[model samples]
Target: MSLRRLLAPLCAGTLLLTTACSEGGEVAPAPRADPPAASDPGEGAAEILADMSLEEKVGQLFVPTLTGTTPEESAEVISAYHPGGFIYFPDNLQDTEQIVALSNGLQDRAVDDSGVPMFLGIDQEQGMVSRLPVGERFPDAMAVGATRDPDAATSLASVTAAELSALGINLDYAPVADVNINADNPVIGIRSFGSDPALVSELMTAEADAFEAGGVVPVAKHFPGHGDTDVDSHTGLPVIDKTRAEWEEVDLPPFVAAVESDIDMIMIAHVFMPELDDSGEPATLSPGIVTGILREELGYDGVVSTDALNMEGVRQTHDDGEIAVMAVLAGADQLLMPPDLATAHAAVVSAVEEGRITEERLDESVLRVLRLKLRRGLFDAAPVDPGEAAEVVGSAEHKDAAQQVADSSVTLLRNEGGVLPLREGASVRVVGSGSEEIGAELEGMGFTLAASAADADVAVVGTNGARGDAEQKGLVTQAQDAGVPVVVVAQGNPYDISELPGLDGYLATYSSVDVSRAAAARVIAGEVNPSGRLPVDIPGTDLAFGDGLTY
Candidate 1:
């Protein structure tokens, strides 16, 4: 069947099924259909934009950070450009109660003044990138990828969307579509599902579908791809020099899958892909890439938002604000985290008034943005029940789901010399940065588990040892003070393990997620054998780790 036919019934069903669950078992089911077909939200957005002075249009283009500002200050900052949307930061979050109230208040004010509901969004990527003060975080994407289970990914997203939706958040910036190409990739390391485009595509598309099915929009981010580069976009622009053939085979396939899956939005990256577009600007601002390629060739009609403009990657390099203007002229519908809304607004408005950015292009973008909002039922939907925010934020079900993902994601990196599967109550010294309990409630669960590192037969070293050089040296000295053979685990970055001292065994989980931590814990306890192998190779290491033990 054609996608449209399959989707039409779903979209129709979604609109018809508005049954809310009444504080009981078996939550309400989804529309069982595709989301409502995309359409312009009428002349409302354009009418408003038309009435908007150049300043307002500029504001509409920006989705600014609401961190570090008072309610009044928040109002003032947004009031300046009347930004199109607002992205939540850690600062804007405190607890479920505060977040719900704040989000509702912000959206209310924007609508009352501007007559349009602002897109309230969060980067609730579950595990590591969560913004909720206390809530469920599923295993990292790598874990889901490891499972290679699209249903698991979809279920995880469904639960996440339901929780975030109850708090009044409409957009989830997640399902990092970047294939895990660079194993040592500092930022996207474990954040990615795995190294294969097909796997990442399938898992992410299912998750995106689940998000939309749950009434929250899913945004596939850091496009054309952030998976292959060695540099972090947060600090500097990383150049991907792969040829068109390689990109099509690997880097670009996942995004193509996501678009075909009908993802609501795409967040473009700021990295320079010299082979694809040698304009020396990030894909976010490159007209050739945005308009000529994404729109003309790829045929994606969804909103194209920029990665945070505050990042040095794009901010330091672009002078004429050439990238921002060019992106819209190219085909993007939204400008996210703009460096300065007013400046961007003026540039866009002046360009439009002067015909540099044709009115047709502006209309096209506004139409897409408005259509997305309408499809989300933003304007018609009632405000979330603020009182119930706490009840829903990090409910027991959510946390349990998170724990399950964590456990399932844990992989045994390596076990040499048949040292694993140790006898119970064996003498062990545990030491590592990731070994410490990152979870708050796990302390009470230690009756069956080891209460402390000294209680074990094996000495394990972990990343929690030292935060800095001074602290790191103190960690080694502390371990030596214990006078036990130790196995060290590196959680954050593998580079720090180069100087690890007084360790008999070494393991790296690459993240502090409960699954990896628990895997390390289980390895020490001898409850579960270390059968999984390392997916990424560490430089200068003689050890070759695959997906499973050799013996």
Candidate 2:
């Protein structure tokens, strides 16, 4: 499918507001749960645990994305397996009113049958990763790293969680713990904080605290790290060949920090680490990685979830049944987006029957999942007021916060030949694929968006995919065709700049968001002096770290 079609459900306007009473209508924030009281005996717990059928237990292991399924379909799916949790994609969300109806409906089904609330999750990492269209989009992890303010990170996460929890979402798949190592890395570039491991660790801690404070469980993800690889796991697998010391210093720190800060879950990366696991398998299914290292050595007892099983990294190598069996044997507590439920469920059953996966292991995940549910007060006699759904989406306060993040994250890479500070009356030609971002951020800036090559004094262009030799050739042609004082913006990587034809100036903000566009606009308009430096070496022999032309 086309990218737009793929993202349509995600970016669709499903979260429309209704005439429901405002959740903010003088209702005080819910009170936090006190420590379990002595008077509160462990009553009915055994019978509740005992009533679970094998299918119900197996279903608890799977959390699928809600796509191509209606509320009735969702209810049927839940009824069949009695899944312990449900994760939402943009398809599941429309507006607050619809989502509220959906969530309440789903929960009502679960309560009517099993008498337990289902865990609701979303990828609300804020900024580019946010699933909530109207919700706040904070600057990416890199921007938080750049700010060097833990409080800012905490505040951003808190606001994100408050909005998410208000919508009945209990879990946030966020706080990317990966450290940015490869500038040209397809997926985790801007998503990570920076190249520094310590900074990422600190930021992740702050995010976890903020999420928990707002009554949302934070899930740190893509462990041990996806930042060093150049390949996108969405399409294919990538390998990281780091020594033990390298991992300890780089990839492992942020995860350790997150664990220490009491983060509730971790999503394992699919990339293989040959150095750590001799089996040459992705870390998600490696017992040595997930069980031995993360659990035994590092002392993390929280939930361990796999990244989407449909991702080519894992799918290409194993069938649904093998993947499910291996993941549980490897000590993963939950499986996300497995392609086939029957096969996966059967695999777990087979493993249990064969003694490869023990009842204890199943109980381990069950207890952990139950603890989270208990903390969320799912067992408590509380009513979910459907009218409160409007409060779950973007509010005026959230949008303003998101805008601030976008504005602050803009960084300037380079401006030489004094081509910048463009003449006030000079016509400018902006040519690029990310027209959406440019229009959103720079439309109000002095320069007008040029429709053709002839009507401009300066030309701007952007590269969409990989940052290698192919991009170099394309940049050169665009610069020559425009035939003006050219300015190139590398949205992904700074690689191959030497290949692009001579230009009066070049800027690298490393992303194509409104923030990056705003930064480029300010630099071109001479409103802000260029201050951002190159974080990685360009793809040439001469360039090296700490040697690039720092603006």
Candidate 3:
């Protein structure tokens, strides 16, 4: 069927596109019957693309970071670059009222300048990598993984979507699909769902679906797996030495699940896998991985976004210009957080003009981006209401949901002779990184607070990654030597338990958020049962995945 014929039904009921209809509504007396045809999804996007200039088309491929909290602060960049989207950082946000104004102002500017609305994005992952400060802080991804419930993942994404949408933010760079198999992984430690590929796949897909259902675009991140690496990609490059089979077994399953579930976007990682591409290029700049593996082998034709271009992992061998051009050549539809926006934008424009990057290639990405925007109703979305935003974000119901996840995720790794569920009204002394918060929670639960371990019946010591911190480990020793029952709580990383051995009781909260801390206090006080299991194996110990104790 012709494109015009297919689009007629879509325009039949709308007065906005009068051009799509005949000069008049005059109909033939005897019209021949035709078979019903399925509408072409790309027709509307293609029509929009046909009218765009080369610069505007190229601009649609870049989602850069804003300079400040308000739209006026970023006016120069917005007017010059015409970015398709803006990623929010901590500095770019203040409170709900300001955020709504910023989002609405930016969108108005984009619409006025180029007749296109911008994609307002944020990394509101709600755990360690959260960007928004006003929402109900939920536990980390690994904490949810410990609960072994996919519903928790869905709730997290759903609540996040609602809160973000209220604040006029539409895209969420979240639901990290990396199956964290390496215990030494610095960046993706607690951000990932779990170590098991199947578990990660299940939870990640659930979150992605929930985000989409709640009218927010979800971007599955660090593709080709940022897990299984010892280096932090933000400051340095991480090289993962794994055979293709090993990569498929460990890193590929979650991405495969994401692809199969039709995720809206996938953020490419900056890790170097020599086995995938021998050219020493990171996944963000390698056609062999981005185009060959993700597009060809995996059949993901949706929007493929590169990780932050400012990161050292992708910047070691190329300048901002080269990195931007190479990412397009490598099949990334979106260039996120480019180090230098002007240089990157000019480079992509020059590449297309010089035949280094074809206009056809550029259109493929622009079309994908436009299709997503159109599909998500970005073209017709109304300005967000600031009053509504205030009522929706960080609501009481949302806080309850967060607390439930935290409560279910408090994994009791060890409770020797039931040292936990301390005797009613037992005097406790809290110490360590989060001791102040933990102590406050215990006091609220009617436990008597003691100044020192020597004066307490139990020493509730909190450790946040005590593996390298001697002071934190010493607190545990002091509690043990004082002849008080030491109940160590691993508030950050679960591996802290291995460092502080011989504890009378041990708990792994997997995060240090207020909700997680409050849940830990409840677990100790026997108000809530410990049901969370190990999401990752404790290195250098017999403790494996799926290990946890209950009251």
Candidate 4:
């Protein structure tokens, strides 16, 4: 079947004005309508948009950060700026009760001031990138990819969405769509699904669908792909040297699949692609990339949000206010995490008034955001119950589901001489960083702790980002030199295996979360059969994608 046929039904209720799919499996552009007057209450988002003042409309374009965990801490900004939403960070989240109170308090103030509920957004990607203080920690994207089960992706995201929604968080910046082809990528290593475009597309679409179905708006992120860069965008801007065709082959499939799946929002990356736009501007502020390619070519009319404006990647040449104006002119609907909310808000209002940004252009974005809020039932949402939230955030059922994903994703890369499935009562020495938790789990499974490599029958050494860690390599070598059978468990990036040449056994957990660690211990104890496959190829080695062994 063709891709269009498979995706047509998914685009039925898309909020874009021009990109909704027709009944005949073809995209039929809807005619743009003039802004409606605030005459009818039944007009939904249109009427709401018309009633908003210019300051209010500009305010709607930004999703800024709050000062503290309490709503009172942000009351000054809320009253003065009338922001459309607030994005939560680790400092802003405490416990379930505190989170519920904070979310409800913020929403109440927003509605009282602007007659619109705020979009409570968070970067709750689970696994390594989680922000919630209370919730089940599921495996990261690479681990989910290892299982080759799209259902696992859906279950993980669904559980995450339920927890976030219970705490009144409506927008989840998650289900990273980048296809990680570059093994040296620092920022997006395990966040990406895998190296294959088709695998990333399938898993990303499943996760996005599950998030929406579970009542949280999922923003498929770092678009045009952040998977091929070696530098972290938070520290500096990374340039992608790929031609447009090369980009289409590797970095474009998952995003294309996301748009077709009716993803409501996409976060633009901060990387600069000279081939896409040779203007020396990052994708966040590039009109050609954001407007020409993403909007015109890809036919994505949903909201386009900028990756946090406070990052150094987008702050190199422009001030916070100027960056805000440029992003709006570049066709972005939301400015996420601006460094100065007051400055960014005022600059946008000034631009619209000065004709640098037309009021119609501003309306287009405000209307899109409003339509999304209405479609997601944000305006009609009631305050989340603190008691219910406490019960639901970290429930036993959700944790079990997380453990299942971790169990299914523990990839056994090598089992030389069938060294795995260690015998019960074997004395093992566990060494290396993040191995303490693993050791505790191993001891619970009837394994005796050894004081040193020479005292142990086997050595299980943990390696995290081990490519450059000489200490980790020394630990493994120390064990091997003592003639102790070594089983190396990669707790972070699986590429660590390439650094250690000779090993009796190797296991890749692809994450260091508690659940994944426990799952690794279970695999070592022969309690669970290892079923995960390699999500990415290990450079300088014969270990390629889909490589794993079972006893």
Report clashes for each candidate as comma-separated counts.
32, 5, 0, 0
* Number of residue pairs clashing in candidate 4, backbone atoms closer than 3 angstroms, sequence gap of 3 or more or interchain: 0
Question: lDDT tens digits, residues 1-551, model 3?
Answer: 22223334343443221132344664322111111221554887787677678888889999998887888887887667778999998898899999999998898677655656778998888778898878888999999899999999999999999999999899999889998888778899899888999999999999999999998999998889889999999999899999999999989999999999999999999999999999999999999999999999999999999999999999999999999999999999999999889899999999999999999999999999988887786776777889999999999999999999999999997778778898998999998867888889889989999989999999998988888899988988989999988998887879887777788989999999999998999999999989999999998877899998887
- Cα deviation at 26, candidate 1, in Å, is 36
lDDT of 2 by residue, 1-551 (tens): 21111222212222111111234443232221111222322323333445566566677788877654345667777777677778888877777766666666776666544544677888888656878755656666766664556876887898888777667677889989998887668888777877778778887899888888888888998888898998998888898888989988888899888778767899999999888898968888999999998899889988899998888898877888999889988989889988887678788878887888888888777667666666555545243455554554566776666555444444444455767767675566666645456534455665666665557677776654434557545654765676677777665545546566465666655555555566657666766555444444555545543432423
lDDT of 3 at 203: 94
TM-score, each model? 0.81, 0.82, 0.93, 0.92
Q: Cα RMSD (Å) per model?
A: 7.8, 8.8, 5.6, 9.3
Can you write out model 1's per-residue Cα lDDT over 280-357, one digit (the tens) per residue?
888877888877777778988888888887787887666536656876875778887767666776788788888888
Ranked by TM-score, the better of candidates 3 and 4 is 3
Candidates' C-alpha lDDT = 0.67, 0.69, 0.87, 0.88
Query: Could you give the candidate ranking by TM-score, starting with the highest?
Result: 3, 4, 2, 1
lDDT of candidate 3 at residue 340, scale 0 to 100: 88
Error of 3 at 432 (Å): 1.4
* Candidate 4 per-residue C-alpha lDDT over 1-551 given as tens digits, one digit per residue, 9 for 90 to 100: 21122223245554222134677767764422212233432366776665667888888898998788899998878778878899999999889999999999998777656666789999988778998888999978999999999999999999999999999999999989998988899899999999999999999999999999988999999988999999999999999999999999999999999889889899999999999999999999999999999999999989999999999999999999999999999999999999988899989999999999998899889888988887787865777899999889999999999999999999999888888899878998999866798889999988998999899988999988888889889989998998989999898879988889889999999888998989999999899999999999999999999999987
Structure candidate 4, residue pairs in collision: none
